[model samples]
Target: MQLLIVTAHPETQSFNFAMRERAATVAARVGAGLSFSDLYQQGFAPTPGRADFQDFPATQSFDLAQAQKAHQQHGGFALDIQAEQEKLEQADAVILQFPLWWGGYPAVLKGWIERVLSYGFAYGRDKTLPAKKVLLAVTTGGIADEQDAQRSQARLQAMADDVFGYMGWRILGLHLVHGPADLDAEQRAEALNSYAERLRLWLSEAVPLAA
Candidate 1:
């Protein structure tokens, strides 16, 4: 099985990165072919624009869908975006690991999605990429209370239904690790261990997507 882990944490020692490392270990244990994209380390561009295309005319108004379709047909995607698309095409499962920045994905990851998953690629095509499993492994500082937790859950569910679901990917799981900033060392370690076990179980099982 091919597995791709895309991590969008700037700090190497951050809790999110630790979780990503745990995921890497689990992928290795499962004997899956693995690939990784450390966006921060690679200095990935978070803004999508004309640079993404090589064949589009400079004077043409940037219509994202039109430009993407044209560029894809002509092999005009920038090197980075093309490489990422290639990786996605080969993956059976994709793990997105990032810290919740201001209640959403980090900008780098958001950009990666916007740029790499282009029209005629991840969507707008007859096939809509390929059927695969997606796991969102997110780390958050803390949720203030039950209301905050509910809000977060709603937002994540919307993403699962609207964003990934619309693109034809299956939502395998949404794993949220909370209180990473406030937790003590032992508590944090325990949380990581628990998450790792959950990941292991998920990897070992063949659970179907929810309707």
Candidate 2:
């Protein structure tokens, strides 16, 4: 299996990064080809602009769809965006690892989605990306409670129904690791281990797309 892990955390030693490392290790153990994009470490640009396209006219009003389509047709996307597109195309599964900030994706990650998953590559009238399994590994500092769990579930559902599902991707799992801020060292280790095992199990199984 080919797996692509995209991590958007800034601190390499944080729990989010630890989860990413564990994912890499598990991918190696399962003999899955692994590719990664460390958004913060790579200094990924989060804002989309004219710089993303080549030969885009200076006078015309910026139209994302038009720019993306023109750039894709003429091989005009920035190198970084092109590289990410290639990785996404080659992967059978994708894992998004990050700490949930304000109940949503980090700015850089959101930017990555906007720029790399462009018109004609990710979605368009005649072009939609092939279905692939996707997993969201979200970390939260707050303790898991009934209310928080409900909110998280709602958010995940929205993402599934509105984002990934709309884009023709299958949602395999939404793993949330909560209360890392209050856990002791042993508890934290156990939490990480349990999540890692869950991820391994999910990756080992064949999950059909939801109808």
lDDT of 1 by residue, 64-109 (tens): 8788887776687988998898899999899999887787888999
Which ten residues in a row are the worst by lDDT in model 2?
A: 202-211
**Against the hidden reference, what TM-scores do the models get?**
0.93, 0.92
Instruction: Evaluate all candidate structures by whole-model CA lDDT and list the values in order.
Output: 0.84, 0.84
Candidate 1 global CA lDDT score:
0.84
Worst 10 residues of 1 by lDDT: 202-211
Q: After superposition, how far is residue 82 of candidate 1 from its true place, in Å?
A: 0.8
Model 2 clash pairs are none
Residue-by-residue lDDT tens digits, candidate 2, 9-39: 9999888888999988877777788999999
Candidate 2 accuracy as TM-score: 0.92
